[model samples]
Target: MAKVNISLDAELVVEVMVLAGVGSPQDAVEAVVRDYIARGHRTEARTELTEQSLREVEATPQEPQG
Candidate 1:
Protein backbone atom coordinates (compact mmCIF):
# COMPACT_ATOMS: atom_id res chain seq x y z
CA MET A 1 0.00 0.00 0.00
CA ALA A 2 1.13 3.52 -0.73
CA LYS A 3 1.89 5.67 2.29
CA VAL A 4 0.99 9.34 2.71
CA ASN A 5 2.05 11.71 5.46
CA ILE A 6 -0.31 14.18 7.07
CA SER A 7 -0.04 16.39 10.14
CA LEU A 8 -2.47 16.20 13.05
CA ASP A 9 -2.69 17.78 16.49
CA ALA A 10 -0.58 16.05 19.14
CA GLU A 11 -3.45 15.97 21.66
CA LEU A 12 -5.87 14.43 19.13
CA VAL A 13 -3.39 11.77 18.10
CA VAL A 14 -2.73 10.92 21.77
CA GLU A 15 -6.46 10.67 22.40
CA VAL A 16 -6.91 8.24 19.49
CA MET A 17 -3.94 6.21 20.68
CA VAL A 18 -5.49 5.87 24.14
CA LEU A 19 -8.93 5.06 22.75
CA ALA A 20 -7.51 2.40 20.43
CA GLY A 21 -5.20 1.09 23.15
CA VAL A 22 -2.24 1.17 20.76
CA GLY A 23 1.17 2.55 21.67
CA SER A 24 1.94 3.80 18.15
CA PRO A 25 0.02 6.82 16.81
CA GLN A 26 0.07 5.40 13.27
CA ASP A 27 -1.45 2.13 14.43
CA ALA A 28 -4.11 3.94 16.42
CA VAL A 29 -5.19 6.11 13.49
CA GLU A 30 -5.16 3.15 11.10
CA ALA A 31 -7.29 1.10 13.50
CA VAL A 32 -9.85 3.90 13.75
CA VAL A 33 -10.01 4.34 9.96
CA ARG A 34 -10.39 0.59 9.38
CA ASP A 35 -13.12 0.38 12.00
CA TYR A 36 -14.94 3.30 10.39
CA ILE A 37 -14.81 1.59 6.95
CA ALA A 38 -16.02 -1.72 8.36
CA ARG A 39 -18.93 0.04 10.06
CA GLY A 40 -19.92 1.67 6.78
CA HIS A 41 -19.86 -1.70 4.98
CA ARG A 42 -22.03 -3.27 7.71
CA THR A 43 -24.52 -0.42 7.48
CA GLU A 44 -24.69 -0.75 3.69
CA ALA A 45 -25.29 -4.48 3.98
CA ARG A 46 -28.16 -3.90 6.40
CA THR A 47 -29.83 -1.26 4.21
CA GLU A 48 -29.16 -2.73 0.75
CA LEU A 49 -32.14 -3.45 -1.47
CA THR A 50 -32.63 -6.81 -3.16
CA GLU A 51 -34.43 -7.88 -6.33
CA GLN A 52 -37.16 -9.66 -4.32
CA SER A 53 -37.75 -6.55 -2.24
CA LEU A 54 -38.08 -4.48 -5.39
CA ARG A 55 -40.61 -6.90 -6.83
CA GLU A 56 -42.64 -6.84 -3.62
CA VAL A 57 -42.70 -3.06 -3.61
CA GLU A 58 -43.78 -3.00 -7.25
CA ALA A 59 -46.69 -5.37 -6.48
CA THR A 60 -48.12 -3.05 -3.82
CA PRO A 61 -50.75 -0.46 -4.66
CA GLN A 62 -49.27 2.96 -5.09
CA GLU A 63 -52.39 5.06 -4.40
CA PRO A 64 -55.38 4.96 -2.10
CA GLN A 65 -58.78 3.94 -3.54
CA GLY A 66 -62.09 5.15 -2.12
Candidate 2:
Protein backbone atom coordinates (compact mmCIF):
# COMPACT_ATOMS: atom_id res chain seq x y z
CA MET A 1 0.00 0.00 0.00
CA ALA A 2 1.20 3.48 -0.86
CA LYS A 3 1.41 5.83 2.10
CA VAL A 4 -0.16 9.25 1.59
CA ASN A 5 -0.18 12.22 3.91
CA ILE A 6 -3.21 14.41 3.22
CA SER A 7 -4.82 17.17 5.25
CA LEU A 8 -8.57 16.83 5.55
CA ASP A 9 -11.30 18.51 7.55
CA ALA A 10 -11.89 16.74 10.84
CA GLU A 11 -15.65 17.22 10.75
CA LEU A 12 -15.86 15.94 7.17
CA VAL A 13 -13.69 12.95 8.06
CA VAL A 14 -15.95 12.07 10.94
CA GLU A 15 -19.01 12.35 8.71
CA VAL A 16 -17.40 10.14 6.07
CA MET A 17 -16.46 7.53 8.66
CA VAL A 18 -20.03 7.37 9.88
CA LEU A 19 -21.51 7.25 6.39
CA ALA A 20 -19.05 4.61 5.18
CA GLY A 21 -19.37 2.55 8.36
CA VAL A 22 -15.60 2.41 8.61
CA GLY A 23 -13.71 2.76 11.90
CA SER A 24 -10.50 4.19 10.46
CA PRO A 25 -10.08 7.50 8.62
CA GLN A 26 -8.00 5.77 5.95
CA ASP A 27 -10.72 3.21 5.32
CA ALA A 28 -13.36 5.92 5.02
CA VAL A 29 -11.32 7.84 2.45
CA GLU A 30 -10.54 4.68 0.50
CA ALA A 31 -14.18 3.60 0.48
CA VAL A 32 -15.35 6.99 -0.82
CA VAL A 33 -12.71 7.01 -3.52
CA ARG A 34 -13.67 3.50 -4.60
CA ASP A 35 -17.31 4.47 -4.74
CA TYR A 36 -16.50 7.53 -6.86
CA ILE A 37 -14.51 5.47 -9.35
CA ALA A 38 -17.22 2.83 -9.56
CA ARG A 39 -19.81 5.50 -10.23
CA GLY A 40 -17.73 6.91 -13.08
CA HIS A 41 -17.31 3.46 -14.58
CA ARG A 42 -21.04 2.86 -14.46
CA THR A 43 -21.71 6.20 -16.17
CA GLU A 44 -19.17 5.43 -18.88
CA ALA A 45 -20.71 2.03 -19.53
CA ARG A 46 -24.17 3.55 -19.83
CA THR A 47 -22.92 6.18 -22.27
CA GLU A 48 -21.19 3.54 -24.40
CA LEU A 49 -24.31 1.42 -24.51
CA THR A 50 -26.43 4.42 -25.51
CA GLU A 51 -24.03 5.33 -28.32
CA GLN A 52 -24.00 1.74 -29.55
CA SER A 53 -27.77 1.66 -29.66
CA LEU A 54 -27.82 4.93 -31.62
CA ARG A 55 -25.32 3.56 -34.13
CA GLU A 56 -27.38 0.42 -34.62
CA VAL A 57 -30.53 2.46 -35.25
CA GLU A 58 -28.74 4.63 -37.78
CA ALA A 59 -27.41 1.56 -39.59
CA THR A 60 -30.84 -0.02 -39.93
CA PRO A 61 -32.80 0.68 -43.16
CA GLN A 62 -35.88 2.90 -42.87
CA GLU A 63 -38.92 1.78 -44.87
CA PRO A 64 -40.86 4.29 -47.04
CA GLN A 65 -44.16 5.54 -45.60
CA GLY A 66 -47.20 5.99 -47.90
Candidate 3:
Protein backbone atom coordinates (compact mmCIF):
# COMPACT_ATOMS: atom_id res chain seq x y z
CA MET A 1 0.00 0.00 0.00
CA ALA A 2 1.16 3.54 -0.70
CA LYS A 3 1.62 5.91 2.21
CA VAL A 4 1.62 9.68 2.39
CA ASN A 5 2.60 11.87 5.31
CA ILE A 6 0.53 14.95 6.10
CA SER A 7 0.69 17.51 8.89
CA LEU A 8 -2.13 17.82 11.42
CA ASP A 9 -2.63 19.60 14.71
CA ALA A 10 -1.44 17.58 17.71
CA GLU A 11 -4.62 18.31 19.68
CA LEU A 12 -6.84 17.27 16.76
CA VAL A 13 -4.97 14.01 16.31
CA VAL A 14 -5.24 13.29 20.04
CA GLU A 15 -8.95 13.99 19.97
CA VAL A 16 -9.47 11.69 17.00
CA MET A 17 -7.49 8.93 18.65
CA VAL A 18 -9.60 9.24 21.80
CA LEU A 19 -12.90 9.32 19.94
CA ALA A 20 -11.99 6.38 17.67
CA GLY A 21 -10.58 4.35 20.59
CA VAL A 22 -7.43 3.78 18.56
CA GLY A 23 -3.90 3.57 19.90
CA SER A 24 -2.37 5.69 17.10
CA PRO A 25 -3.38 8.90 15.34
CA GLN A 26 -2.86 7.34 11.92
CA ASP A 27 -5.22 4.46 12.71
CA ALA A 28 -7.83 6.83 14.11
CA VAL A 29 -7.80 9.08 11.03
CA GLU A 30 -7.84 6.07 8.69
CA ALA A 31 -10.80 4.54 10.51
CA VAL A 32 -12.75 7.80 10.32
CA VAL A 33 -12.04 8.16 6.57
CA ARG A 34 -13.11 4.55 5.94
CA ASP A 35 -16.30 5.07 7.88
CA TYR A 36 -17.04 8.26 5.91
CA ILE A 37 -16.58 6.42 2.60
CA ALA A 38 -18.81 3.55 3.72
CA ARG A 39 -21.48 5.99 4.79
CA GLY A 40 -21.37 7.70 1.37
CA HIS A 41 -21.82 4.31 -0.34
CA ARG A 42 -24.78 3.49 1.90
CA THR A 43 -26.39 6.85 1.18
CA GLU A 44 -25.90 6.38 -2.56
CA ALA A 45 -27.43 2.91 -2.42
CA ARG A 46 -30.48 4.18 -0.56
CA THR A 47 -31.11 7.09 -2.95
CA GLU A 48 -30.37 5.28 -6.23
CA LEU A 49 -33.20 5.09 -8.77
CA THR A 50 -34.08 1.65 -10.22
CA GLU A 51 -36.08 0.55 -13.26
CA GLN A 52 -38.41 -1.59 -11.07
CA SER A 53 -39.14 1.33 -8.77
CA LEU A 54 -39.94 3.58 -11.71
CA ARG A 55 -42.33 0.97 -13.12
CA GLU A 56 -44.09 0.62 -9.79
CA VAL A 57 -44.55 4.37 -9.51
CA GLU A 58 -45.90 4.58 -13.04
CA ALA A 59 -48.39 1.73 -12.45
CA THR A 60 -49.98 3.34 -9.40
CA PRO A 61 -53.58 4.58 -10.04
CA GLN A 62 -54.61 8.07 -8.96
CA GLU A 63 -57.67 8.41 -6.72
CA PRO A 64 -60.56 10.69 -7.67
CA GLN A 65 -61.35 13.68 -5.40
CA GLY A 66 -64.41 13.34 -3.09
Best model per TM-score: 2
Better of 1 and 3 by TM-score: 1
Sort the candidates on TM-score, descending order: 2, 1, 3
Model 3 misplaced stretches (Cα beyond 4 Å):
49-55, 59-66
- Give the alpha carbon lDDT tens digit for every residue of 5-60 in model 1: 99999999999999889999999999999999999998787667565688899999
So what's the TM-score on candidate 1?
A: 0.76
- What's the lDDT for candidate 1? 0.91
Clashing pairs in 1: none
Task: Estimate, for each residue in 1-66, the C-alpha lDDT of model 3 and write its tens digit.
Answer: 999899999999999999999999899999999999999998777667565687789899978989
lDDT of 2 by residue, 1-66 (tens): 878899999999999999999999999998999999999999999999999999999999999989
Top-lDDT structure, candidate number: 2
Clashes of each: 0, 0, 0
Clash count (model 1, backbone only)? 0
Which segments of candidate 2 are over 4 A away from where they belong? none
29 Cα displacement, candidate 3 (Å): 0.5
